[model samples]
Target: MALVHHDPQDGILITRIGQAEITVRPEPPASASGAPVILLRVDAPMLDTLAAAYLDPDEARRLAQALVHAAEAVRPATPWRSPRPNTR
Candidate 1:
């Protein structure tokens, strides 16, 4: 069986995966209240996006905030920095 999933609720988190991908799809129409479509895709194991969520903008924002807060709580003291672009 494949390892890891977009969210812990969806699959078991047994292995230590080094990579993941999160993508935000195009939003639904402003007035389309009933149209709750999948807005985010979380792909673990780095190869496929097998998990998704149909969250509205507000819900997405709240989830993002929670994730950031929890991440900060357990994050290493040394901040993670983006690599500088190579200049040739």
Candidate 2:
């Protein structure tokens, strides 16, 4: 990733996601101190298409693992092989 924007008043970025968003903040009344949780949401919305979910740190970790597991389940054991070149 590149430093697209930088400003002392804008604050530093903790991380970035592709077509998705994640924010960590304390729950409930912003004034009151509470356990910090995460808010996961999609970056873009097509025709009001967006998936938003409130998840704790633990749940976030599990979600990551689940994503990996699901991806691996359908992932090919070997990489795709291109067709052989024609000798003719």
Candidate 3:
């Protein structure tokens, strides 16, 4: 299985596949009412690619917020850790 790593500080998830790496991050919506978007960037020794997708705003917000929380959780004690993790 490929190893996956998360860097909450940068709001990114990375997966290593063979010799290539895939990175995922959230991108701001293009329109007020449009769905949230997730951007994907793939990099290999010889090539690179980029892609994105729009998803349900509610769901996206939940996910994005979760990631931000995760990023905070991994940090040393600080003010941002007061809030508990979401359970939904």
TM-score of 3: 0.38
**Residue range 1-88, candidate 1, lDDT tens digits:** 3343335453223323467655555445557556544367666865754687778667877987998877766784468744658998
* Candidate 2 residue runs with Cα over 4 Å from true position: 1-31, 76-88
Among the numbered candidates, top lDDT falls to 3
Q: After superposition, how far is residue 63 of candidate 1 from its true place, in Å?
A: 0.3
**Clashing residue pairs in candidate 1 (N, C-alpha, C atoms within 3 angstroms):** none
TM-score for each predicted model, relative to the true structure: 0.44, 0.46, 0.38
TM-score of candidate 2 to 2 decimals: 0.46
List per-prediction Cα lDDT, in the order shown: 0.60, 0.55, 0.70
Candidate 2 to native Cα RMSD, angstroms: 10.6
* Residue 56, model 3, lDDT: 56
Each candidate's number of clashing pairs is: 0, 0, 0
Per-residue lDDT of model 2, residues 1-88, tens digit only:
3333344453323333554443333244334665656666544433446666777779978987998767766884458644658999
- The predicted structure with the larger lDDT, 2 or 3, is 3
lDDT of 2: 0.55
Candidate 2, clashing residue pairs?
Answer: none
Q: Which has the better TM-score: candidate 2, or candidate 3?
A: 2
